[model samples]
Target: MRENSFEHYYTQKPSSSLETREVTIRLKNGNVYRFISPSGAFSFGKVDKASRLLVEYAEVEENDRVLDLGCGYGLIGITIKKEHPDITLFMSDINERALKYAKINARDNNITAEMRQGHLYEPWQGYEFDVILCNPPMAAGKKVWQEIVNKAPSFLPSGGKLEIVAFHNKGGSRLEKTMKEVFGNVRTTIKSGGIRVYVSLKF
Candidate 1:
């Protein structure tokens, strides 16, 4: 495929060269995870800072049904399952290479998760989640990211939450505004690195 293009990771069948690497991420809670990332996935060589922050702060309960939208190599969802095994986790992405590694990572970690391949909420049409986590693909542009923010409510029940991380200069402000407009309430937790975690509750 196009080398390092934004659309490379969103392709259903990625044509990028098959190169793989293994990465270990140590979570804030001292839990460690190992993942296999291939060339055609986002953050292929390491765990992304935004995704790391999302997993660190995204609130999840023991029995919460969680959906990791656009889960690249299953970092967010797999980490959650590792911490709270009782929570049901679902991971979806459009990249086949990412999905393949996600399944492998989950299996290697001995974590149970449903991995589906589809764009944003399409594969999860009939499913509902108690918590949704995303580190949206900002390179995909505002319309794509905003669609993720806007469509989250329909998949969530009352009291359910949607949490996302974005760079302040890279659509975080717009995301906050969209969350406020869509969910009626939005809370932000900011980091010194200009990364903002936006949380919205469906009520």
Candidate 2:
């Protein structure tokens, strides 16, 4: 199960031998960013399509407090911060190795963000965010992703947005339904390459 599933990227401590590589991503807006991705982290060679879609489509505003839930190597949050410097950015991930690389990537890219290592939203229990963005761990099973959807409202103020990305055929449809169930409203704002970005506004 460990070898087949995405458990390695979702664990607090990954068992894989440490290996690192530098990845560069150029966004649609022509912004180029670099990140240090380690072995056992998700999307090690480049930013995955789902995450890139989330980064591009999610609505961020000036001075908004943004939480990048399940951030892997700081792709979404770090990129958003670079794009909108005024927004306060927070990033968290269950995987310690991912968090470590996220921190390094943040520094390397000259982006400032608060990073925490914990499962789901535990690291930010009492905090509220204006926007929460995620590229969920689909292979980690339903419970993990369900927790993210079910508990997101508690950490968001009324009218706050929660955005997540996945392949429509590969668990994205279920995620859209779950978000609608939790938040009472949901919409797909972006779709390309079989990936979809689902957005919900908390009431």
Candidate 3:
């Protein structure tokens, strides 16, 4: 299926006319976050179910270095930082507009994080993290997600983890398999509303 040009949130530069709106979300933990959403960012005004689920259930340890790959509008990373203040948070997105808003949201939320703009792991080359969380761009195509899985191991140390979320029937199963293939083990740590969060450990 060919996705419309406007729907390609994975693009480095979005062609959609830039428009801004403020979004406030109250998560299950009773924490509220504010974000500046712009046109062309994924799930612009609201956090999608899959991402919300990932934010609610993705595991992070204190003092761990974390990367939110493809972090749209900084939701996952920001929420994780709020929950685990001790963990160092890093966010990167291919979408320039999204990255810009991510920085603003971090500031609005009173969180400090290292922000970078690049495709996939490009901005973080030579850097390793204790955990990597992603709501992979399924709309971008299998190859993109495959690269995320295959290349993730090298960016993590032994016992480091990669956690990802997707709908079970809609590429989640395939992503699980790829994680297992690359990391040699995978586990479903949480599932809700047909979305599953898969965790893989680098061993």
TM-score preference between candidates 1 and 2, better one: 2
All candidates: TM-score: 0.95, 0.96, 0.96
Worst 10 residues of 3 by lDDT: 1-10
TM-score computed on alpha carbons, candidate 2: 0.96
Q: For candidate 3, lDDT tens digit of each residue in 32-116?
A: 8878888888887776799889888988998999999999789889988998999999999999989999998899899999999
lDDT of 2: 0.89
lDDT of residue 73 for candidate 3: 89
Worst 10 residues of 2 by lDDT: 1-10
Clashing residue pairs in all predictions, respectively, total: 0, 0, 0
Better of 1 and 2 by lDDT: 2
Clash pairs for candidate 3: none
In model 1, the Cα lDDT at residue 101 comes to 89
lDDT tens digits, residue span 52-104, model 2: 88888889999999999989889899989999999999999988999999999
| Cα lDDT for residue 147, candidate 2 | 93
